[model samples]
Target: MSDRLRVPSSVSAARTGAPFIPRVLSIAGSDPSGGAGIQADLKSISANGGFGMAALTALTAQNTQGVRDVHVPPVSFLRAQLEALAVDIQIDAVKIGMLANEDVIVEVGRWLAEVRPEVVVIDPVMVATSGDRLLDPAAEDALRRLLPLAHLVTPNLRELAVLTGREIGEEWDAALDAAEQLSLDLGTAVLVKGGHLAGAHTPDALVDAARALRQEFPGSRIDTTHTHGTGCSLSSALATRRASGEDWPTAVASARAWLRESLEAADELQVGSGSGPVHHFAGLWARGSVMTRPQAEQLASDWWEIIRPIRDGIDELPFIRALADGTLAHAPFVFYLAQDALYLREYARVLAEAARIAPTSEEQAFWAGSAQGAIAGELELHASWLTPAQGITAETFAAAQAPATTAYLDHLRATAFDGDYAVLIAALLPCFWLYSDLGERLHAGAFGEYARDPEHPYASWLATYADPAFAESTQQAIAFVAQAAASASPEMRERMLRAFTAASQHELAFFAAPLTVAL
Candidate 1:
């Protein structure tokens, strides 16, 4: 996993004051089971921060088991739906899926030529997950003609074989060759999916013949049969990310990451007995109880539990364990103190900004006092550790600042300036809550007896963690953030949860920095 958290492009853009919501259109067939085709497209688009609209080319009687039958509407009605949306709304991107026949393909091609949407992602949905053919074999030529109209075409192994007129091979090299040939012939980028290959890892590549680029995205094959609409969901998410100002590679990477998470959480839905649908809003649903309307304390507890792995990882770090046992070398201990001093400098500023944007007088006063305490109290502790007798000077202290420290401060600063009060406070809470919790445990001899031993080398530092006043401050911070989240809109609450989660992860990274640099 990447150390840096990646906020979606739409959210990042909003932080920069653009606030653009991509208007995405899905021109595809309909699945009554809501697993694939236009249904999956709409869900994927919305989950990726796009406003989704749909124009149906056909309707399918299908479920996770298989496609029972398909009914194509007249080409005229499909054209009417496309024209109506085109005239009324400004489409930022278009996703084409399951064009049932030659006429529907040609109709969508014509509309594309006329409207010229900014980004077009075509998922050549020829076969269902159950190996049922959705497109007529006779329409292959027309579909090939329609390929060049799209910015990118996503094709599974079988569909690539149909497009390239070759026997489908089980080798990854053969797949790449076929993808490159299709890209060359159609003058568009090709996303070659390796789901059909017999392997432990499912790999994907974006081949652009014109640019002479072949970017590979390696992934593990999720051991699940419930990926009913992965292609439709991925293509729609790719289009939405592109429309939100991400480049082709970035958009594909983001969409693939999201799809993997959806697949991981697929079993939670249990929509069908056979192959089931991927949970479209898995990340949002997991972040907070958006559907259940949780109380403030419940939400706070959930957030803490969600970061349990991170907290556990922190406890097992060499730096943390060494410090708790009072066996840490002096240089590394001084290094940690210097980095903490650097972090508290920016952290204090973010706290002040939180106070400025706070809604109530109580919140404002709490944040403001916390900021002052961070500077006046925390920095003083750090200063005593960096004495000249320790051979640490001003220049040495400045040089001790690490990249992990900067990354944590960057997240806090970004949230302070760009995010609302609710999210900013959420981002700020992890520092108080995690440290206080760790301190209280250590003071109570959770790790060892050094924390309570006055003669211990780092007893002063450990004593600070057990401070009753600081524990009270941490509780107040948690209560304020939880109350704010409870009162927020569902969307805003989700954002808060994401901010809190990211901050907790950063805290883990921060604690690992000193030993990482020493090694």
Candidate 2:
């Protein structure tokens, strides 16, 4: 049988053509710290596309460091909270966490039997990440009785051991064996988390023993201490996704991906001195601009810094050093110039395309003029060096086009045709930025002073790039691309950064091509 949740038509139907938002109810304890229990559940439900509701079983005075004390409310009051929502609101899914005693567990189980939410995910929160016990020893049997009421049970290593009445070993395989047995005994799916295991990887598995099915999700362990509410958040997210009609594996996969992203950004919060809370809204805050976006100039500086190694590699290339000191062999120099001529031809077309698709007239004009310069100015310089009398003709230039030259041109062409204006401009910026920077450095005697000497064999060739006008144009290109990136959406900014990095790598390859092929 398929693992997909069969969402009821009432739950799945669109209201007035609006998207159906699952009404996810959290039957868990309250955490004053707002990191775990019902607090984390509500947050995770909302973040995962659900309208959140809570029916508290207990309340805890706790912080990120540890739980100080717990208060269990009257079982009648807990029943009242569950009943009130059941009468007025249709709950699409329920996530249960941290029932402090047998009475609380029994009450929640009775409510589940009556209300019967379409999706039920129970996070057996028996022990805290700080090694504090949340569940009472006497309530363990009651919690076992409640397990069968849930469609899925999320258990950490210790919790799984308690539920299965088996001492689970430290290895992941042992955890899976226990999970399989628990799933068989309880007649429900089990989400066995490997976060507490010893290794570089944290693997989670969904096991359905009746169906003889097991799907393992492998993940790298994030080096973080701020995992205060990971189980609560993940279970709630899974409940929300299942309520939204996702299959078992897909829901687990989606929740795990979101959880990992949250963990990665957890340190940014710094909420407490000990184990901290994950940033529940990291993706939303970034994309919604709640997080500060870097300014254009700062972005340029950051991008330049990010590619320092690539820049250094270009500087160390024999081709660049030899051309700087005018000691480059005739064959390699001619080969390089011929390839540059061919590259300029396609690079000019890409620049023209960038102009055609530019959003603003100023940007359009700048790209158009740069395209003209690529064709007229750069090709003319290449022609001066790659003369037919020197045994380098149009055929010679075409035939000598190295793989690196073709690769660089292909990158530009692909970006120009397939990517957006922001991404295309970012890809184009590296050529201008790297060449001008290298040119200025060579002129200032980075390689040798021969590049500036009038009598140097390649002096005029080197001077073309070092010209103040070219440097000015490079700065202008950088400003335009950075401005475009600054106002872009988070997703667009990432694409731009990737394109810029790839282009920088291509620049290094293009510079190293001549000598690589010659050698």
lDDT of 2 by residue, 1-519 (tens): 123235545444753466888999999889888888899999999888889999998888889887788888999999999989999998888899889899889889888888777789999988766566666777987888888888899999988977777887577888999999999888889999999998799999999998798999999999898999999999999999888877789999999998999999999998979788888989877757566877999999999999999999999999898888788888887777777888888888999999999989999999999999988788877877666455435653555568898888888888888859999999999889999999899889978877888888887778888999999999999999999889998789999999999999999998888888854
Model 2 TM-score, 2 decimals:
0.56
Model 1 segments more than 4 A misplaced: 1-16, 128-133, 291-519
RMSD of each: 16.6, 13.5
lDDT of 1 by residue, 409-480 (tens): 889988887959999999999999999999999889888877668887998888887899999999999999
Cα error, candidate 1, residue 422 (Å): 8.9
Candidate 2 ranges beyond 4 A from true positions: 1-5, 14-18, 130-133, 291-519
User: lDDT of all the models against the reference?
Assistant: 0.87, 0.87
> What local lDDT score does residue 345 receive in model 2, on the 0 to 100 scale?
82
